[model samples]
Target chain A: MTKEHIVSAFDRDLEGIQATVMKMGGLVEEALRGAIKALETGDTELAQKVRKSDRSVDELDLKVKHDAARILALRSPTASDLRLVLSVIEISAHLERCGDYAKNIAKRSIVLAENAQIEGTVPALRRMATFVLSMLSDALDAYIRKDASLAEAVIERDLEADDMYNTLFRSLLTHMMEDPRSIAAGMHLHFIAKNIERVGDHATGIAEQTIYVVTGALPEDDRPKKDGTSITFKPSDE
Target chain B: MTKEHIVSAFDRDLEGIQATVMKMGGLVEEALRGAIKALETGDTELAQKVRKSDRSVDELDLKVKHDAARILALRSPTASDLRLVLSVIEISAHLERCGDYAKNIAKRSIVLAENAQIEGTVPALRRMATFVLSMLSDALDAYIRKDASLAEAVIERDLEADDMYNTLFRSLLTHMMEDPRSIAAGMHLHFIAKNIERVGDHATGIAEQTIYVVTGALPEDDRPKKDGTSITFKPSDE
Candidate 1:
């Protein structure tokens, strides 16, 4: 093949893999939103739908990984091209995990539907999910636009998600302590909140991949993380 | 360079990456063991030490990834050789996350040390950790020896971990419900159990990579997953 033709083919291959990643990202976002909506409305049907859709997300992720590896073997892409392929693999993996978290949330929503709503937990969780959803969208946009600053912004926004989660954690604890009967429901809500928090982390991971692809190095390891639930032994009321 | 010399160098490069992965796996296992010991004994110092040691694991993971990328770019390995390199990258990533879960357990252990013990949670968590540690070691051994059957066995063993986690989940909830004062400690123990359960999942992921490296395709997605916590609203008490 002519040199120009070969280079063009390689570019097309990279674009194809990236486009699939975007499609996968869209499915994940849909799944996240659908899961939260189901949680809010106690819609078991919607939750089941979200759970079923995750298989498509997983399939797309595998396709992206396989395509990127093929390009790595065939094109022998170097420098930024190589980084792009590696970053795509990492990004797709992160997106797939996010999809799994969404599925977990859906599963919990299905169960939580039968139980009495834990006071205000669902609305607070919805807000947190909304924030994390924005971060996922911005992270995907940063990858597509090659905008490092936007990716960095997504990383910084994770602090906000953490803060929201902590607030929810304290409130859920208070609700459970007041009524032991809500213990199971509160625990499920806590996991749902935790799942949303992890989605934010995965979004930040996607942002990091973008920064890596652009600058050829990951940002400093000391990214801001305000998650304190692991160390929190006392509810704020105490 | 002679063709034979180049081939030999590629083999050396692959070996170097694999050795680093084993080293990373060792560090992860140590961290898991230390974290459980700290939890069982309420040894805050050991917990702190386990948390500190995770940075080394992270650094080794970065080195392995960089070495794999360098080999891919320079050697342009294809077919099985390329799969080996990709698998190393994935295996290292899984090991790194397992390290993170261990660190989380350590962090929680530090907090739990100050609280009254939550009945039998610590011993149960330790048993679960031990089981997960074995799975991790076997997964690493499988990777080194290219034993797909051993890796498959590790994959099957995750169901037992999930079953153990479910038992812990119910017992912890019962304790919290019986005595509202233990809610904080119960939550912390629940998270610790969850962390160990995730370690098993990561080990299974490593095994899947080994399988992919050996067989060129991932196993079916319908592996045994008995983690019913997300779907269990009654806590086995109702």
Candidate 2:
């Protein structure tokens, strides 16, 4: 092949890898939705399905990373290409972790199904999941369009995720205190809330990587401040 | 300058960046120890000290990333050299987050001190901190030596950290159930344990990066899995 042809071939390879990442991300988003649906409806079968799908998520993540490494070694891409490969790898990792967070929620849903009911907290958890799902969807959209503002918007939602989590944390504590029988269920619910909160974090991570890929510079000064909400479970009624 | 001289200068730049990473790692290690000590002793002043120190860690991380990017752009490092630069950036990010985890522990320590006492979980949290600190130290050494075995060892320790966190988790639940007054303290302690657990996770992440840096191929098959322990909380006596 001519030198120009080889360079074009390298671009094709980078494009192929990016397509794989989007596919992987789509699967992950599906799993997150399925996990949440499983939880809301208490469907063990759907929860089991979500758990099983994580293996493919893991496989896809490995393929993306390995393919990116191959490009680095074979193409020896220049600065911009190198950044693209690196961002793809980082974003894939984030997506895989998001998959794991979903699987974690599914596992908790199974546990919660067998325990005493704490139905009050379910709406809050669902809202948290819905909000995070939108953040993730938008994050992926931002990546494709190279939209820094959209990415920034995705990151800003993380603050809302945190606030929602803090509210859930206190409400769960109150429920547990009111009925000791619900403590086990409460703990599992708290963990599910935490898992969803972390999904928001990983999504923000994707947004950050997208920012770096688009802009040569990191967001230095105006990085959004994380909510310093206390996780301490003090009931207001106390 | 001769071509050979230019290559040698590039090597020196890479070496300097590696040293900077180690310095940042050391500072993070110190911050973790300080955070743990402050938490264990309920020393709010020491906790304040750890929180203040995180700024230096953040600054170091930013400097490392910027320097690495310059090397990528200006020096145009070879494939292997590029991998080294990228690994340094990823590892530094991990270390900076490790520092944040410590800072978070410090922040929570301040809140815990003002809450009612829950003395039983302290020693367990201390042991968990000590274990994760050793894991991080070893992982950094593994990176310096390019020893995959050492990295694998560090990765394996994360299992133990997870087990320890689970134990601490169960005990905390028991305490919360036994004494409602301890709920607030128990919640804070649980958060501390979680922060420490994430430190172990970040250490494993560094070790994984080290393996990739040494071997052209990413470790595909023998990847250390997070322990799939049950998240269901149950009282020991029950």
Candidate 3:
């Protein structure tokens, strides 16, 4: 085959991979929202949906890898084409883990919702989850569009999720301290914040991978600053 | 260069990268143990040591990547050799993150040990840390030796650490419930358990990478059971 033919073939494979990943990302995003809603509204049906949908994410993960490998074996791509395949595989793996974290949150939400008193800090948990989901969506978009700048923005936004998680944990701890009866619910909330923080971290990982795929260089850690309302990403070089 | 010379050069480069990663792993293990000791005995000096030594691990990470890239550019390896280099680069990244987690734990230990009365959970944390360190060590060994079975064993052992973390979190929660005054300390301990759990997850990631490098397949979820004791690895037919 001519180089042009190979390039086109690889591009088609990558497009397929990206489409599958975006589909998976959409499912994970829904799962995260459903998990939080399950917690907020005590919707066991939503939690069950999140649980059942997790298998689809996992199956998509395997399919992406299988298809990527077939492309590699048949085409024997080189250089950037090869890196793109590897990055897709790694990115899909990270996204699958994000789904797993969301599923964990859904399971915990079910438990927390079952409790009678509702003793935990709910608003902080919701805020953190929202920030995490936003980051995930932005990061995936940046990857699909090869938008290094947008990926950098997603990386910057991760700090907001982290800060919110920290605040949520502190609030939960305080609640448990004031009323020992809040321990079970408060601990569940802590796990939820932790899962959200991890989702944000996975989003950052995706952003980093996007940067690598686009520029072949890892971006330096550009810590975002908190201004009470939202965290702003300021690149270190800037 | 002849194919034989190129192969030898790649082998030497792989060995060099493997050596640096193992050194970094050892340093991280020491840092994890030091952090636990600092928390258990309130040793700020030890925590300081861990925090300071982390820079060396970061430096090693950069050095490995540079060496791997240089080898790739010079030799232009194909197929399995290419996969090996890519896996090394990715594994090094994971190892760097593990080092970061250990440093974070040590930093938190300094503040937590200052006022927290930690009595019953220190041993569990230490034990879990030790288990993770061993798993990491074995995973590295499996990579160097190209031993898929050994890598599988390391991956299976992660369940033990997970169980320990869940139990530790529950016990700490109960303690916080019993004595509201211990809330801050208890939360700190909970974070420590979390760090250890993350360390185990990183180890598992490394093990999976090792297996992938050897067998060219990703392991299924295979999370450890909840008993904190034994685990089995069942390879998927796909």
Candidate 4:
């Protein structure tokens, strides 16, 4: 093949790989939204759908890795192209993790659906899930556009998700404290909340990879973390 | 430079990256051991030490990624060498996550140290941590030796860790249900248990990478997972 033809072929390979990543990201976003919707509406079937969708997400992740590896081996593209390939692999990994968290949420939602609804918990969780969903969607958009600024914005919003989680965690604790009878349901809701919080984390991870792809370096400072539930606890005696 | 010299330099680069990964893994193992030890002994200072050690692990992870990217760009390694580089990147990422989980355990240890020790909790956690620590150590060993069988063994052991986690989960829930006053502490302990379980997951991840590096293909069957907490919840009234 002519030199130009070979270069174009490599570009095509990268484009194909990236396209698959975007498709995978889309599936993850759908899973997150569907899982939360199922939790909010008590739709076990929808939750099952979200859980089943994860298989496609996992398969796409594998495909992206395989195709990226093939490109790196055959094309030997250097500089920006090399960064793109590496970033694609990392991004795909993050998306796969997000899919897993979404699946976890869906699984818990199915269980929560069977139990009596924990009063006022689903609304707060829904809001957090909505915000996280936007962050993930924006992060994926930034990846396609190579917009570092947009990715930075997504990173900044993770703190908000953490803050929401903190509030939900405290409220859930109080709920269980007030009525020890709700402890089982409370634990399930707490895990679902934690799962949503983790989905936000993976979204921030994707945004970081986007910044690395565009700027060739990760953000210098660690993103703000407001998860204080690990350290803060009200003694029952108090 | 002679082509032979170039190849030798690439070999050195691969060796250096692998060595750094092993060092990072060693730090993670130390952090895990120290965190669990702190929890078991109620040593806040040891917990602090484990938390501080994570920065070094993170730095080593970045170094491995940077060095691997450089090798990819400069050496243009193909086939097995290329796979080795990719595997190093993945292995380093897994070890970095393990470091994070250990740090999380340490953070929780500090908190738990300040609070009253829940009876009979520390021993169970310690046993689980020890098993997980061995899995991580063995996974790293498999990586350095390219021992697929050993890696497969580590992967198999993850199911056992999940089973241990399930047992711990039920026991903790029972503890909390009996005394609502212990809810906060129970939640923290549950998270610590989850964190250790996640460490095992990452170890399995590293082992999977080892299998890929050795055999040029990932195992077709999914590793077994027995984490039933999300799906199984006994009603509080029961």
Number of the predicted model whose lDDT against the real structure is largest: 1
List the candidate numbers ranked by lDDT, top first: 1, 4, 2, 3
- What TM-score would every model get versus the actual structure? 0.95, 0.89, 0.84, 0.94
Q: Please provide TM-scores computed only on chain A for all of the candidate models, following their numbering.
A: 0.94, 0.91, 0.87, 0.93
The Cα local distance difference test for each model comes to 0.89, 0.81, 0.74, 0.86
TM of chain B, each: 0.94, 0.91, 0.87, 0.93
* Model 2 quality (TM-score): 0.89
Q: Which digits, one per residue and each the tens of the lDDT, describe model 3 over residues A1-238?
A: 6455555766877888889989999988998898888888888788878877888998998888778667665666656666576678778878888888777776776666656544446766787788888889999999988999999899888777867776676667667777788776776677677778888888998998888788876676444422111111112211
Write candidate 4's Cα lDDT for A1-238 as tens digits: 6555555788889889999999998899999999999898889899889988988998998899899889988888788899999999999999998888888888888778778776899999999999999999999999899999999999999999988998899999998888887788888888889888988888898999888988888886467653567666523311
Point to the candidate with the largest DockQ: 1
Candidate 1 lDDT for residue A95 = 92
In TM-score terms, candidate 4 sits at 0.94
Misplaced by over 4 Å in model 4 are A1-7, A234-238, B1-7, B234-238
Q: Model 3, stretches more than 4 Å misplaced?
A: A1-7, A63-83, A117-120, A222-238, B1-7, B62-79, B225-238
Residue pairs with clashing backbones, model 3: B159-B224
The parts of candidate 1 lying over 4 Å away from their true place are A1-7, A233-238, B1-7, B234-238
Deviation of model 1 at B136, angstroms? 0.5
lDDT at B177 for candidate 2? 85
User: What is the overall TM-score of model 3 with all chains considered together?
Assistant: 0.84
Tens digits of per-residue lDDT for model 3, B68-152: 6666556666567666776776788778878877776776676665565756888888888888888888888888888899998
